[model samples]
Target: MSKMYLELAKRNLQRAKVRSLLAVIGILIGVMAVSAIGIFGESLKAAVLQNFEDVANELIVSPNFQEGYKYLDEKDISRIKKLPNVAEAIPIKSDSLLVESKKKKSYAVVYAMDEKDVEDMFKAEKGSIRLKSSCVVGKRLAEFADIRVNSKITIAGREFRVAAILEDTGARFDINPNSAIILSPEDFEKVSDVGYTMLIVKAESLEKVDDVKKEIEEKINSRDEKVVVFDLKIILERINEAFSQINTFLMAIASVSLLVAGVSILNIMLMSTIERTKEIGIMRAIGAYRSTILRIFLMEALILGLIGSAIGSVLSIAGGYAIDLMILQDASYVFRLSTLLYISLGFSIGVMVSVLSGLYPAWKASRLEPIEALRYE
Candidate 1:
């Protein structure tokens, strides 16, 4: 009986070769788009999360500011260091500046800190910072600036010798490797004369985040008059809220395509059943069960779905590769196992939808009167 069903499905598929091919192609394209999107989104999230973790262990502390920009003074850093469960706290007087060299120049966001902190931020590729009058440049900056080792560079109206060039790590930053320069906060002070602007705190563990944050807030508020530590969870929630909107938009668009596909499946299956009425009638006459007829049509539709979705998955992978090359050529971004799970889930759902779509047509096919079907054909 299964063999008979397969034979009928193959014949039916062959009868409308172009239509079947096109339907499968449509489904394949849709599935592939979804798969590629899943890979890209997951990879992006992981990269950003790693970047955040690199800044500190779990939580970060910055002054509560209305403009989303502010720095913790040196005194504030000293106090946060005293908090329990603290690991290592680093202070950076960071700001952006347009840097120029004899070769070329681009605007750079520069972080000013002690030489030790600056050294840890990047590996020197060309030369070493002399600590007194030399500056470290990012790899991209060195090539873009067209500067060689021991070259002179100027930033924020100050001159410094090029101590070292950093390896390109594809990270956006204010110098160690990217378009950034790391100098002593004291030296940065003489150039810009701006007050301390940022402090990066590294906590010991996840469990201590809230406790450390609360301690710092209470301690700072008690000592100062109006300063307050704004809640960080609120910020994360807001970011999630934005992503939710994006998720909704993508789902809605996918739904439109799915609905069209559903309608197409229903129409095609119903027509096939109408044409195969005599075959169904012959089976019924031979004592074949109605359930068997239904199964045949459902299986046919399921096969079509699987074929289409497989095509889509292939398309998606190719598209994903192209996008990865454009955006993160050097970065490691691959389809996650979860993406395969998602594809499996998608494939299963398509098969189920195809089966469901043929239900009425299949039932009608099974219920046809053998005498009437034979007389008409």
Candidate 2:
């Protein structure tokens, strides 16, 4: 029965090649919108996460102070280390300063992560620890700042040799606004005799991140003389939430195009049904069951959807590659495979919609009386 139904469906589709083609195109467009959004979201997330890990582990601890820098000190670092799921704790300070290397110059965020902790967090070809008189350069910063390996640079009247150059890892966030400079704990002390500002903490896994966060938060909240400063994770979360809303808006806008496609599909199917009213009546008169007639029309819709979606999906893949190229050229990030999965899923959704949209038209076509159809002919 299924095979016979499929054959009838195929024949009907073949009879209206142009209309079927247009319906498929509609499905393809809807799927393509989904694909583009999915690719951007996943790849951007990966790039951001890579920056997060580059800091340390799965977690970070900031002064839980209710005030500001006044509430944070070295003591918080020690306490955070004792918290559950925290394997290591390191103090870091990052601030922007005026810098000059030879005649070249830049204003950059100078990081003060623990030499060993930063070393453990990331690997370098040369040196991770800079002597009190030296520092390291991030890849993008090095290129932008135009400094060479082992070259000497001065920040805030303190001169230091460029002890190492970090390799490229697509860590735009960690780079801290497109430019970042690394300084060892010793060098950090040179900048400010005051206590360190940030604590780098590592967790066992993603599961442990929240636990560690809560542990550190409660510990800091207990202290009486503290000023609250936004922790890095909280700030990052706020940023992520904002992006998610933007993504939602983008999807909502893209849906307009999908709706247009849906209407196109409806119109094409309706027109096809009207033009074939006599034929529909003849089939009914010849003893075709309503169910078979419905199946035949629905199959045509489904086939059209599949064709369009497949084409759109292929085009989306190509577009993703183009996007990847543009990102690499601009920010050194690339799309991941999960992004493609989203594209495929989007196409499938389009296919499902195509089938659904045809139901009413198909049912209408199946109900024609043979006598009336012949009389009209």
Candidate 3:
């Protein structure tokens, strides 16, 4: 029975190929618009989360700097270490310097930290970190500079060997880690001032994060000291909130296309009902039930929707890639799984819109009296 209904639906749609194609095009456009924005949003969220994965369990303390340029030094680190629930306080110093390879020159953030403290944080894509007088180049920095293991690069007028190439971290805190250079504290001191820019503190456990943060603030005691505490979880939550608002706004804009598609479906289905009225009346007279007639018409709409959605989903991959290239400038940040899921969602929405839009027309066709429909024709 289902097969018969589907066959009838197929035949009916086939009789008006051009009209069916146009309706499918309308649905495809709607799905594509919604899907493009959804893919971009998911990609952005994934990039942010991936960038923070290594540091999500850590808290950052930096200068409030409301009054003047204040620095976080060893003294503040010592105080924070003594606080209850504290685990370790590691200081990081950062400065921007010109980096030059044989092929290219780029400005890069140079980070100075205790190599032992951040040993586990480094994921090498090409080589290894040997720590003294050697620099670990980020994935992007290595690519941009066209350097690799044993490649010599000059930074801040000092020459160093590229001991390792770190894996690309899709996002970063202040500077993109994928485009940064890591060095030991002592080495960095030789090139620039030893003033610490920030402190990374590990809590005894995730539960102790808030307590550790408060104690550090109390120990620092003043904005003059330039102490500002940032909880990673709170930062993540805020980012999620901001992106949620952005996603909603983007989806609203995309939904306008879908509304237009729905109207197109409604008009097409109504016209189909009028054109097939005599045929419907003949079927009713031949002992076909009203439910069967309705189902057949609804099936036709579903088929159109499914075809449109399939095409749109496939094209969304290209659309997503274009969006990433134009906006994100890197394919590394686009989350593949989430993108596929969003495309599937777009397809489902397109199908649902088509079926719902066909409802009234299907009902009206099912209601046509056999005698009146046949006599009119």
| Top TM-score model | 2
Ranking by TM-score: 2, 1, 3
Give the residue spans of candidate 3 off by over 4 A: 48-54, 61-87, 91-199, 204-229
Poorest lDDT segment (10 consecutive residues) of candidate 3: 168-177
Q: What local lDDT score does residue 372 receive in model 3, on the 0 to 100 scale?
A: 83
lDDT of each: 0.67, 0.69, 0.83
TM-score between model 1 and native: 0.70
Writing each residue's lDDT as its tens digit, candidate 2 over 275-317 gives 8888888888888888877888888777777888888887776
lDDT by residue (1-377, candidate 3, tens digit) is 99999999999999989989989999998898888888888777776676676666688888768846567767777888888888777888999988889999878899887677646666788877776889888888788878999989998888989888988767555335688888888888877885888888888877888888888877786555558888886777788889878876897799788878888888988998888888888999999999999999999999989998889888887888788878878776455787888898899999999999899999999999998888765
C-alpha root-mean-square deviation, candidate 1: 5.3
Q: How close is candidate 3 to the true structure, as a TM-score?
A: 0.66
